[model samples]
Target: MVRMFVNGQAMSGGSIHAPLTDARFLGRAWTAPRYRFWSFRDEFPGLEPVSTDGWSVPGELYAVSYAVLRERLLPLEPPELELAVIELADGSGSLSMRVRAEALAGAVEIRHPDGWHGHLATRQPG
Candidate 1:
């Protein structure tokens, strides 16, 4: 099975998350401390690797089979998102979704505490 890291609406209790339900949840994980994060119109998060100092973005990991990866997950993903190898905190790598440069234009920078969950919290209505 190929493991993939999910950092946006495909996460638990999120929109468009059903595709991952049958996959094995590998619990929470973080990226290497060199990535930038953004919320694209509050619809989803987009992460990119940067050379400057950055914090690890928190997210979930899953073990998906090749059929699911090629046939379902990849196809269901937004056009702006692409599959790329991501460096994890555990000194390992997993296939992750990275945002293309075009998608991040005019996006809201998710600085400090790089986590989608934290960003989502700020958007909740009290």
Candidate 2:
């Protein structure tokens, strides 16, 4: 299983089984519209079981324009950060993500179709 140490906590997903240093663990981007979010999970079937263990969180999907995606995530990433493209499982397209060295901390703001915004934070260990 691929293990990612996000904020010192270990997160393993089926799609990632190699060491953290593996290139695969680098920036992996995935994008799905508000409609076909399930396809994202389907692409990496192996990750399903692991994804449920701790990484699973109820998150609503939003359709973000490519310009907005670049404006939000790319600018915040460090210079050394790697870029990965996560293609929406539903075949819509892909989103860009920057893999950081630090543990997965902070919250992600997702905008729903109805103009509602939700913030999701990483699961904290007890």
Candidate 3:
């Protein structure tokens, strides 16, 4: 099982876990969009589409949108709260990661072979 930590505190089990297997992280960067938008033209007829700029959505709506969008694009689960890139040690090899939600801000422990261990910290956002 994987253990999760947030801001240096250990979170309980059952948090979503997504392995970073794809090589997309090789050159890509995570830039929180200055604006996030969704169109409603198709869903609501006769009503003009609505657009929201900036990160000012209500807490519930924001949470729902975060969950939907993250799941649609990646393997992230709900309530994790942010994004981070991590590297884990597994036996003779290591695994690199790009995770979402509260799992973003901290270091993770990776147990190594021969009873050794390693810790990887999340990268700072620009």
Q: What is the descending lDDT order?
A: 1, 2, 3
Flag regions of model 2 displaced more than 4 Å.
1-60, 98-125
Residues 1-126 of candidate 2: C-alpha lDDT, one tens digit per residue: 221212111123322222232323333223333221111111211111122222322222333444533544335434433444333434433333323334223323223221111111222234
Residue-wise lDDT of candidate 3 within 54-90, one digit each (tens)? 2211100011233333443235432332343222122
Top model number, lDDT: 1
| Backbone clashes (count) for model 1 | 0
lDDT of 2: 0.27
Candidate lDDT (C-alpha), each:
0.85, 0.27, 0.21
- RMSD for all candidates, in order, please: 1.4, 15.2, 18.4
TM-score, per-candidate, Cα-based: 0.92, 0.26, 0.17
Better of 2 and 3 by TM-score: 2
Lowest summed lDDT over 10 consecutive residues: which window, candidate 1?
A: 105-114
The digit string of per-residue lDDT tens for model 1 on 1-126 reads 988999888889888688888999999999988788888888888789899966788899999998988887778788878889989988899998899987877788886474887887888899
